[model samples]
Target: MGQGEPGDLTGRAFPLGDWGRPAERLDELYRWVERGALETAAWYLADRTGKRRGARVLRGGAAAGAVAGAALPLLDMTGVVGGVAPWGYLALLLGVACVAADRYFGVTSGWMRDVATAQAVQRRLQVLQFDWASESVREVLGPAEGTAGEAAERCLLVLRRFSEDVTELVRAETADWMVEFRTGSAPLGIQAGGVAGGRAAEGAVVPGRLGVPPGGTRPNMPRQRPPEAR
Candidate 1:
């Protein structure tokens, strides 16, 4: 579909007629989606539907406030111009109260939106971690016989260590967001640790020689014995 047009059920083009072309319709759809329309839609579809009712009630309260607000000025003007409307001032007060109540409810909805966004992000990260761990494990241990399984196990151990490290990093980030939301402050910096010693030791081993550095000037000369002759 073109920009701004709402797509049909299969995301095909659907012209919205003189309602400002397909592109405008699509833009409106995206605007609604970003503004919690999907969650609101689900709430409407639920059997219990208490949240939907509550939202309707809040909206009705806001509408009542808006109507009262509009009427208050006219009532005040009439009163000042020698019109005998004793309840005009009271109406103005009620309108102000309604507007304040509407604002409070709006803030509540905003907080709920933040929570929903956080939960969605958490689910996405969990799926990513699962896939990464599974693939890394398979890659490290998917060949050879008997002893090969042991090597794979070692690899998995190292992978889990790294995964845990990465998970801590993610948790720190999540915590930072929470802290910022609650206190309006940034989190302190964290220190980095050295690599795991096991992996470092494994890197030191070389084929046909123990504890030999690659491309170093060490004089290692005896490598003639076959397995049977050794």
Candidate 2:
């Protein structure tokens, strides 16, 4: 990395007001992890509630258009809607529009990305908690390792590392999402009727595509920032 800006993940400050206070270190770590996890979870819910519905609706629309297009031609055999010629074209257009909308919005890809990010964050949170426990054990087993200040710094190091890891994960996810929005990522196809796009919209549910995931928020507690490493 060249000169890091304040906005750069590694350079950002996580001010820990009471980080050095012996009584508040545990609380501070808890606060830091919870806040990061909360934002990540909110994204998961937003996509579950919003974008997911839109994807489903678009897919349903494409299906409906396909049905109408198929039927209209048969109906034309029986002389319906003046002739199937115009009606068939309209149905075909509807399918294309729905498919195109699905691809352009990227709702399907978005939810998958959010879910993956949320799961990744959860795994890290688990690792942080376990690390805290491991460190506590080490402290008990060998408190004579160094001075009190050194011990506090050790705790600070743990907190700092956890905070940085979470920050980097979230920042990377958000950046990729923004870039995807600014410049589209057309899949293997964007041809007539957007057959590829329609497949993409429906692809989320296609079993092997998404893989396993993560969950469950911790209880409510007063928030605190992770200790800033000196």
Candidate 3:
């Protein structure tokens, strides 16, 4: 066997095969992953904001309607119905309108769908980032049963396929939303709610994960930077 430095592989910043093709291709892949992560983050923020606001509006409307309805009979019994009956009726109508807006007009549903899509994208990004950090390109792309050059080529091929898959997934998700927006069909919230109800009926409901995954670090991956560096 040829002699080489013992720490050569262990000391490198990345686990890619070499400094030539695999390194270059992996660098490009990392750039694309970083961009996708940024876009997903923005989408997630917008969806989360919309979801919270919509929920608040729905709850407020329900509370207002309840208070008004409860007071109507009391006002009538006290012989003061004439003064407040109209306002109570008006409040009830406003509450009904708000509920209809949330349910039928797709405000709440749209946000729900966006949030789900954003979360899916975020999960994919996390998987890719974790793989990049912990696994060598050869191991990720294949069984790592070949020479360095063959591994590099396999790595490139796998990255290409992964890139295409990610692109297609994102395109399909965005297109689905666009179609809903254009045609005014059921948004993701309503569909997911239906499925959830079905599952509950069948005793198959499962809770979702609520904890954050472990984080990773890489250059050019948007995170808090030191003030001097910024």
Better of 1 and 2 by TM-score: 2
User: What is the Å distance of residue 211 in model 3 from its true position?
Assistant: 27
My TM-score estimates for the predictions, one after another, are 0.30, 0.63, 0.57
* Predicted model with the maximum lDDT: 2
- Residue-level lDDT of model 2, residues 1-230, one tens digit each, is 11122323322134367645763766565566556555554545544456678779888988888888888888877875557767876987898889888777776666655566556656666776787787677777877568767876777776656555554444444445544565554221111111111111111111111111212111238989999999
Per-residue lDDT of candidate 1, residues 90-170 (tens digit): 555665665555444433333333333233323433444464456446545664444644644554444444333333332
Model 2 misplaced regions, further than 4 Å:
1-20, 74-82, 144-147, 186-230
Model 3 lDDT tens row, 103-183: 655566556555654555466556666656554744656554667677557556544444443443333334444445565
Q: lDDT of all predictions, in order shown?
A: 0.37, 0.54, 0.49
- How well does candidate 1 match the true structure in TM-score terms? 0.30
RMSD of each: 25.2, 15.3, 18.3
Order the numbered candidates by lDDT, best leading: 2, 3, 1
In order of listing, the candidates' clash counts read 10, 0, 0
User: Model 2 compared with the native: what TM-score?
Assistant: 0.63
